[model samples]
Target: MIFSLPVQQEPKKYAPVRTLMLYLTEECNLRCTYCFVKKEPKYMSRETALRTLDWVLQRNVSGGEYKVLVNFFGGEPFLAVDLMQEVVDYGRLERPNLYKTFKFSATTNGTLANERVERVVREGQLALMVSMDGGAQANRLRPMVSGRESYSLVRKNLPRLAEWARLCTARVTFTPDNLELLKNVRDVLNVAPVGVALCPVVEADWAGHEQALEDAYAELGEWFAAEVRAGRRPPLEVTWELLRDYQQRLICKRRPQKACPLGESLMAVDSQGNVLPCHRFLHRPQQRLGTVEASELPDERWLYAHLKRAEIPDCETCVARTVCGGGCRAVALDGGYGLNEVHPYHCLLMQAHMRLVARLYAELRHDLNFWSGLAQVPTDTLNQELYQLGS
Candidate 1:
């Protein structure tokens, strides 16, 4: 009931969104192999940053009445703190002129988490999502400057990060591949780190790891569901319960032509002020919707027009294509993935979780029969979020 999808919807206009993402800086201090932007410290100019927000106000009026959420993302968003603050300040100042409410959030690594940074978030009342791979081994993948230790610095910064988190909605990630990570973070659950959860490794090519991933999630989901059923909740990586139905509606082949909510309203601006269809595909600069200077807001760029084109081979004939919208342009382009030719391998990870949820849903269905139709689903290609989540 919390989701708006169940409401009878039109087949044509489906991609309504209440969100937007801004790349404060493509400059990241640490080198992450899985980085989608592949950017480093080049930050957004104050003018471009403010213009991006102002454009959203315009889009709301030109578009419709809907929430416009601006999530500050970065190579490391903390590096562009000033610009982040500028957007927050301007968003609050210019909000009254908008078509709807404007909210803020950020996706960052915890290294720059401090009182000053926390103050900006608190004052702006922003939501937060911080990245930290499992306890230490995973942390090794994210090395700081001069080849210095990251875990020690992260450990030292966590308490400050925890304090900032206490004042906002926050989350943490642990992508586990072995028991070493599983055992080392025993104290993580007890820590005041907003909420805790694990991320499934998605960079793998073969999709061979899915069996293990699903098995782990099945066990984890069962445990978490049981805890929640008993009124005690152990938070997992992302709140699976909240996203389950959202994914279901997306993979439902029975649906009709629809615009991607992200394609229509939620736009992502990259480090160079160039706009992208979504954040997951920033690396494919060729697919840009033109620079922020060009619009300062969302527009019907050639890329946007292309994504929804009725003749695009992959989408028009595909059943869930509209719900997924010819797949994420960037993921397809960057990974050299075959469109229509392939089943969007990103679904493997999502379906693995779905598999777990289906099992849990089955166990819980006796008291909750809403998803009885999903009982017979045989495969897991039913997820589009994991591709975007990993991309």
Candidate 2:
């Protein structure tokens, strides 16, 4: 059925909101061959740490509703366990109310995760995003510092990891070699993670539309659907929802106007109090907005510039231009390195995302009345509708 715009336009719902990733340390212990973060031992100084937190808390002055997310990342975030504990512990004590709501999470290789780390995770209630490509071959690609493949190591530590996280996930990397094993890998590692997040692998070597990826997508979709159908409400975050909105704009010939939310709800404070666009945008020299050390949280004017900047030239004429915001900035930087055109994977993943999102959108539109309120609806769908009004 055609989704005609209703008589009174539904107010823009979810604007692609931002989540801040606080990089506590850049040093990493694992030698994942596919590591997206450029590894260096640069650690956050204590002073830098305090100031970064200070900036996050200041937004209370703005007096707005925001989802405050602090993502601890590192060569291994747990490597700086002492610093990690200190900041969160001190922040809670010092500033009782930092944002509207506070949420914490981390993505790690799980090599440094220990019982103490586990305790902090439980106490602080962190969302755990762990990395595993597949089984042995994936481990070969994402090996650890002690000459260990992460698959076995992460699997061994997972029981404790699962218990620590309110939610847990194995952040699998999908390269062509292991792309076909998407479901096989999940079955092999079979731990009760909060949910398995299916991410399209992007790198300089990512070949386009392999039969393996297609097969994997079909299998992965079925596997994920089966779990939900079986009443396992594990939360798997897929970009396909984002892709569908991207497609609707294309199909309906609507221009999207919502801006990239890098500096608004989200802020990335690198180990040195260096505020950046976000985690994915951190590594690149050009992308660094400013060091949190040099300035307080960015003023609205500066943030507006960063948020609205046409960093990627290709987005100029695209229908999904606004909400997608040319996809993630650092991703465009990394994958688009040379001629630096938009990552071809954007199109591929958008194809898949749009496919999934369209199907879901169809289902949701069928049950439209049942879904209401911005907070009540899923984020991906909200952003789609909002983009149309260029919110």
Best candidate, TM-score: 2
Residue 56 local lDDT, model 2 = 56
Tell me the deviation in Å of residue 180 in model 2: 2.5
lDDT of each: 0.55, 0.57
Clashing pairs in 1: 15-261, 27-40, 27-41, 197-237
User: How does each model score on TM-score?
Assistant: 0.74, 0.75
Instruction: Please write out the lDDT profile of model 2 over residues 1-391, one tens digit for every residue.
Output: 1112234533232222245677888888878666667788889877777666655544333445454556777768888887778766755553333334456677777666676797678777877777655666676677767876667777677777877887666666666666755657555346554455555555535465555566666665665455444544334444333544444565786554433455555557777666675666656656566665553433434446544433355566543453454444456567654322446566555455445444544444433231221122245422222211100
After superposition, which runs of candidate 2 have C-alpha atoms over 4 Å from their true positions? 1-18, 94-101, 225-235, 239-260, 295-303, 306-325, 336-341, 356-391
What is the clash tally of candidate 1? 4
Against the hidden true structure, what lDDT does model 1 obtain? Answer: 0.55
Residue-level lDDT for 346 in candidate 2: 61
